[model samples]
Target: MTAALLAGVLAGYGIAIPVGAVGTYLVSLTARTTLRTGVCAALGVATADGLYALAATLGGPALAAALRPVLGPLRWVCVLVLLALAAWGAAGAVRRYRHHRLATHAGAAPVSPARAYLALLGITLLNPTTVIYFAALVLGSQTGDAAGSGERVVFVAAAFAASASWQVLLAGGGALLGRMLTGHRGRLVTALVASGVMTALALRMAVAPV
Candidate 1:
């Protein structure tokens, strides 16, 4: 059980520590919104991670085999989705900046906590790499037969907890960033930089060897 717990924690951090396009967006979104909303969004990401971990634990080799064939296509889909999000974020930020300058007071629509949660969840779910990571870990660890049900539960819970902690820390950093950059130009620059980073990461994903 202890070994399983440790492995799960490692796996969780292994997947979550990489600040990819999703993480970039999460931080930028938090900078634009409230901490409460960011927390919800962060949890949404952890929830998706937990779900993938669970699937890996339960399905093991079969799941990995099934996903292997479609990984290329799924990766393409993820890249496209991320690119679209980057475009949307950049465009929205420009529009908001223009309106702010014009004193029209028209800003981007606020994302409620619930909607933010769902949106982040969907975005994370679309990343097939996450599932592949978990599946590989599960298969490599060979914990399915030896760990038993209780240990598996602990493993899943631990993975979720680890991911949640890391994501929340990211959100906290974003909140601090938002506090530091309260001006219109600062916000616009931050948004554009984040959009550019996300776009670059998405492109990298497209060209990366599968």
Candidate 2:
């Protein structure tokens, strides 16, 4: 159990610490919204991670083989979705900045915490890497045969906790960023930069060898 827990922690951090397109978006989303919404989004990401981990534990090597064939197409879809999100974020930030500058209160309402949670969850779920990472960890560890039911539970729980903690820390950093850049122009600039970073990362993911 202890070894399984440790392995799970390492696996969770291995996947979550990469700070790819999804991580970039999470920080930017938090910067544009409240910490409460950011926390919800963070949980959403952690939830997806946990779900993938669970699937890996249950399905083992067979799951990995099944998913390998679909990875190429799935990655393309992920790239397109990320590109769309980047464009939307950039345009929305500009529109919001203009409205704020003009002191017009008729702009679109802020995203609610629930919606933020669901949106992040969906975005994270679309990333095939999460499942592949989990599957790889499971197969590489050779834990399927040795780990009993309780050990598997502990592993999954530890992974979820580790991921949640890291994601929340990211949200906290984003909140700090939002506080630092409270000005309209500062927020707009930050949003644009983040959007650019996200787009670049998405393109990299698309072109990366599977």
Candidate 3:
């Protein structure tokens, strides 16, 4: 159980530590919106990761094999989803900047925390890499053997906790950045840069060999 727990923690951090397109978007989104919203979104992301980890643990090799067949299609879908999201964010930033009321506009519609959570969760779920990552770790840690249900549960919980901590930290940093750069131009620049980065990442993912 301890070995499974440690392995899960390491696996979670290994995947979450990278500040990829989604990470950039999370930070920028938080910077633009309120911290509460950011926290909800962060949890959404973590929840997705945790769910994937659980799937990997429970399904083992069979799950990994099933995913391999559809991975290429899934990757393309993920890329498209992320690109769409980036465009939306960029457009919102542009509109806010042009109006010169970026802050007010950002917080205009009091977004429900539940909705925010669901949105982020849905977006994160579109990321096929998370499942692949979890699968690789499960394969490595299984020691050429299957794990018992108890061990799998511990593994999943550890993975979830690890991912949650990292995501929360990202949201916190974004909230700090937002507090620092509350000006219209600052928000505009940050949002645009983040969108660009996410677009680039999506392109890379799309073109990557399946």
The weakest ten consecutive residues by lDDT in model 2 span: 101-110
Q: Worst lDDT window (10 residues) for model 3?
A: 102-111
Candidate 3, 15-89: lDDT as tens digits? 788989778878887888778888898889889988888887777677778888887888888898889978988
Candidates in order have lDDT scores of: 0.84, 0.83, 0.81
Pairs that collide, model 1: none
Q: Which segments of candidate 3 are over 4 A away from where they belong?
A: 103-110, 143-145
Reference-based TM-score, model 3: 0.92
**Residue 65 deviation, candidate 1, in Å?**
0.5
Error of 2 at 1 (Å): 1.1
Give the higher-lDDT candidate: 1 or 2. 1
Per-model TM-score, in order, reads 0.94, 0.94, 0.92
Write down the RMSD of candidate 2 (Cα, Å): 2.0
